[model samples]
Target chain A: MSTNQIFIVDDDDAIRDALGWLFRSRGHVARLWSSAEALIAGGEIGRCGCLLLDIRMDGMSGLELFEWLRENGHDIPVIFLTGHGDVPMAVAALKKGAFDFVEKPFNDNELVDRALAALDIHHQRSSRQAAAREVDERLAQLTSRELEVMERVLAGQMNKVIAMDLGVTMRTVEVHRARIFDKMGVRSAVELAQLLTARTPKPD
Target chain B: MSTNQIFIVDDDDAIRDALGWLFRSRGHVARLWSSAEALIAGGEIGRCGCLLLDIRMDGMSGLELFEWLRENGHDIPVIFLTGHGDVPMAVAALKKGAFDFVEKPFNDNELVDRALAALDIHHQRSSRQAAAREVDERLAQLTSRELEVMERVLAGQMNKVIAMDLGVTMRTVEVHRARIFDKMGVRSAVELAQLLTARTPKPD
Candidate 1:
C-alpha cells in the first residue's frame, strides 16, 4: 500500500500543531489546514488519502464540509473529531457515511488506529473501483461484430445461430469468439455472461 | 485474485445441487458435501475456498462445523444458508465471523452478489497478507547491521547517532540509508516507517 497523506482541518492552532507534531513523530506526513476552504482550495481531494476533520469550525462546520464534498462527488474517507455535545451530530454523519468519529481528548493511539483503518479501507475501495474501470476498458476492446456475438453468446446462443444471424460462416464466428474470450480473459461463454451481467448498468 | 474452490455442505440434496450448479455455471469449482465429516474427509481445510453451509443439518449443524473449523485453525469464510427459523443462529454465526448468511428460498441474484463480494474481500485480505510477506522477505535481505541502521533510521534517529550506535562512520550510515530507501521504494524515513507499521499484526 502507498503511504497516505493526512489532511487535518482544525481551527485551533494549538490542537493543529499538537496533532501535526504527533503525526510527524510517528513517521507520518500531516498537512494542517485552519479552515475547510483552505483544505478544499489545496486541491488534495482527488489524490488517494484521508481527511482528519474537526466537527466544529469557525465558518464551515465539519458536517457541512462533508456534505459539500459529497455533493461535489469527492469520495475521500473522513474521520471526524467531535466534542461531547457533538456526539449526536457525529453519529448522524456516520449514518451518512462518515468513516468514524473520535470524541475530544481521545487516546492518541485510538485516533491513529482509526485513521489507519480508514486509510486502508479508502485504498481498497479505490483499487476496487480502478479494477472495475479496467474491466470496462477491456470490454470496450471488442469490435462491434464481436460485441454482437458476445451478446448472443451471453443470451445462451450457439455459434451456429450467431453465424447465421450475422450471415457469416461458423468458422468466422468461432474466430471472433476466440478473440472475445482472449480479450475478456474468460474461459467459457457462461463466465463471460456472468461478467457482462455484473457490469451492466441497471436502470435507476 | 486467484479463484477459490467453494465447499457447499448441506443436507438438502436439492439445495446442494442448485448451489453446485450455480457455482459451476459461473465457472467456479464447487464440492458439495452432505455432512461435515464428508467435507473434512474430502481434503485439507487449507485447500478449500469458502464454505456455503446449512445451519441445520442432521449429524453436524453449521455452528458445530464453524466451531470445529475455528478450533482447527481453518480460517476460510463461511456463508450460512439458513431456514426461516434459523435467523438467530445465522446472526450468531455472523458474530463468529461467518462471512454472511442468507435465508432459505433466497433470491439467487442476491446470494450470488453477496458471494462475489465476500470472495473479493477474501482475495484482498489474502493479497495484503502476501504483500506483508513480501515486505518481510525484503527486510530479511538486509544484514543484521543493515537492519539495525534501518530501525534507527525509522525511529527518526540522526545519521551521526546511528553511526555511533553501529560503530560506523557517518558516510557509511548514509550509504546504508540510501540502499534502504531504494530497496523499500520510499523517498524518506517517515514513508518507510509508514509502510512498515501499516502491516504490523493487530490483536483481534
Candidate 2:
C-alpha cells in the first residue's frame, strides 16, 4: 500500500479538515493548507503528488497559483475546487493545464479517487522523464562521428556498408561501433535501439 | 498473440523485404510501401501503428513525408532510415517529430524491436485519445445552467448552498441538478466527478 501524498489547499477550515481526514482514512498522507498563500509559503511546490485547490481562495486564486507552479516547472496534477458561478473559470483552468476541477460540495470518495488517479499520472510521467534523462545523458557522451555510427549500427548496418557509405575504412567504422557500445553501456544494437525508442520525448 | 502492425516505407526493395521478414517472424503484421507517394496515395493516414521510412527516397524525401503526415494530423510514430552522410538530416528529423532514425545497413533485430515498441506507443496514445473524446462528448451535452450546476455539485455543494451561490431558488437548483444528471448520464456527484476526471484533456 503506497502512501500517496495528497495536498489540500482551501481557505475554509471545515473543508480542509474534512478533506484531510477523508484522505487519511483511505491510507494516504494528507497535508492541508488554509489558502494558496500558505501553500506557497510552505515551499513544497515540486513535491510529487496531487494538489486539491480551491478556485476562489482569499488571496492568490487557485488559477494564479496553478500558473505559478507551471511557470516554475512543477508538474503536480491539480484538481480545483470551484464555487458556484466558477464553472467557466474551472473550464478555463482545465484548458490552461489543471488536471481537473471539482465544484464545492464535492463527494469525498470522488475527490479521493481523483487524487489517487492524479498521483498515478505523476508517477508515470516522472518515471518516463527519468528514463529519458538517462538516455539523453548517454547520448551526450558520444562524439559526432560516433553518434553517426551509432545510428547506422542501430539501423542494422554492417561495418562494411557503413564504411562504404561514410567513405571510411571498415576498421574505422568498427572502432566507432565498439566505442559507441561501450559509451552507451549496451552490448547489442537491439538493446541500444530499445533504449532510444522506449520513451517518447516529453511534451513541450 | 497480438500481431501489432508495422508500416515500412522505403524505396530499397532489399531493406524493406528484410524488415518485413524480420517483423513477420516476430509475429507482427508488416505492410510495405516503395515510396512516400504510394503511401499517400493509399490514403492510410491516421492508422494506428508505427512507420519506418527511408530519409532520402527517390521522389519524396523522408523529411517531406513526415511533414505531410503531421500536417494532415497523422500521429503514426515514424522512424527514419537514413543512408551514409544522413546523420545531420536524421538529427533534424528527430527534433522535428520523427520518433528515431536508423542508418542504412540497419540491424534486423534492433529495427524489429524498435518497431514493436513504437507500435505499443501508438496503441497507448490512441486509446487515451479515444477516452478523451468520450469525455468531451459527454461534457458537450450539458446546458450552460446545467453545466454550472454540475460543476458546483461535483465540487460537493449541497442544493441549498448552490441555490444561495447562484442566486436561485433551492427548488430551481434541484431541478437543474436532476436535468444535469440526466443529460450527463450520472447518478451522483461522485460519479460525475469521476467521469470528468477520468480522462485528461488532449494537449493543443
Candidate 3:
C-alpha cells in the first residue's frame, strides 16, 4: 500500500481545511478536496487510504461518490462526515459498506482514530490483492501442457496414468510436472494446490 | 446453527415486548429480556443469533454485557439500542466491535433489517468456525505414524523419500499414505493440503 493517508472532502472551507491540518499534523498526507467531484478529478481514485467525505456535498454528494466507488470496483474504506440530520444517511451508507461515520463536531481524537482504523482495513485489503495478483501472474506463466499436467498432479494422479491419459510417455509427463512446479514457484504439487487454495474467498 | 433469532435486552418492558413481537412477526424466535442479567441467567450465552442490547440497563449495562461477552469469547454480533444522548456511547461501543447500533425511536423496519444483517454475519462466522472444527476433528483421527506420513505428504515428499526417512519400505509408506488419505477424507495429497490451507486465517 502506501503511508497512512486520509482524503478529506467537504464543501465547507473551514471543516475541510481543519481536517486536513489535523490529519497532516498526525503525519498523514491529507488530501483536501472541496467536493467529491474534485476528488475524482484530482486522480486520487485508486489510492490506498481512508476517505473522509462530507455526507452532503454541493456536487457529487459523498453518498453518490461512495456508490460510484463501489460500482467501479474500488474498495477504499470510507468514513462519512455528517451533521446530526445526516446521521441516518451515514448509517444507511454504512449498510452499503462505508466503514463508519463521524457526526459533525466529531471529537478530533475520535475522527482521527476512526480514520486510522479505516487505513488499517485498506492496508489489509491491498496486501491481499497483491498476493492474489502475484499468484495469478505465476499461474499465467504455465504452458498448456504444463497446466494439464499440473491439474492431474494436483488431483493425485500418478505419472504413468497421466501419461497414458494424455497419450504421452511417462518421461514427458514428468518433465511437464517439473516445469509446472517451477513456474508456480512450488517444489511440490501439494504446495501448488495450497498456493491457489489460500487465495480462495470464503463465503461471506 | 439455529433459525433466525434475536435477543432483545432492554431495561424498558414495553420496548422489549414490542421488539419481541416485531421479530416474531418476521418469523424469528425472539428472546426478550428486561435486562442483560436476565438474558445471561436464561442461558442464551452460546446461542447463534443477533443481540439487540440497550446501552443502559438496570442491573448490567448493555456495554458491560458486551464487554463480558467479548472477554468470555462469545462472538454473537451485537447491535446497541441508543437514545439520542447515547449516540456517543453507541459509537464508542461500535469502535470496540459492536456490529451496529439503532438510535431510538429507530425506524422499525431499519432496526429489523440491521438485526437480520447481523444474523447474516453471525451465520458466516458460525459456518467458518464449524469448518475449522471439522478439519480439526479429521486431523485428530490420525495416528501418530499416519500423521507423520500426512505431514510429509503435504510437504510434497515422494513415497520413496518418506519411506527412507521413516526407515520403512516403499510398500509401508504407500499403505500409510493411503490410510492418511482415507482418514482425511481426501482423494489426493493436494486435496488434503488445500483443505488445510482453506482454513488458514489471513493476516488482519
Top candidate on TM-score is: 3
In candidate 3, list every pair of residues with a backbone clash: none
Model 1 chain A lDDT-worst window of ten: A195-204
Ordered list by DockQ, greatest first: 3, 1, 2
Which digits, one per residue and each the tens of the lDDT, describe model 2 over residues B121-149?
A: 88887776777677788789878888888
Q: What DockQ would candidate 3 receive versus the native complex?
A: 0.44
Interface RMSD (Cα, Å) for model 2: 25.2
TM-score of each: 0.45, 0.46, 0.82
Residue A123 lDDT in candidate 3: 87
Off by over 4 Å in 2: A1-3, A35-41, A164-167, A202-204, B1-204
Q: Give the 10-residue window scoring lowest on summed lDDT in candidate 3 chain B.
A: B84-93
Candidate with more favorable, higher lDDT: 1 or 3: 3
Assess the local accuracy of residue A140 in candidate 3 as a C-alpha lDDT between 0 and 100: 91
Q: Where does candidate 1 clash, by residue pair?
A: none
lDDT for B155 (candidate 2) = 59
Query: What Cα-based lDDT does every candidate model obtain?
Result: 0.76, 0.75, 0.83
RMSD of each: 18.7, 27.7, 3.8
What TM-score does each prediction get for chain A alone? 0.78, 0.80, 0.84
Compute the lDDT of residue B80 as modeled in candidate 1.
81
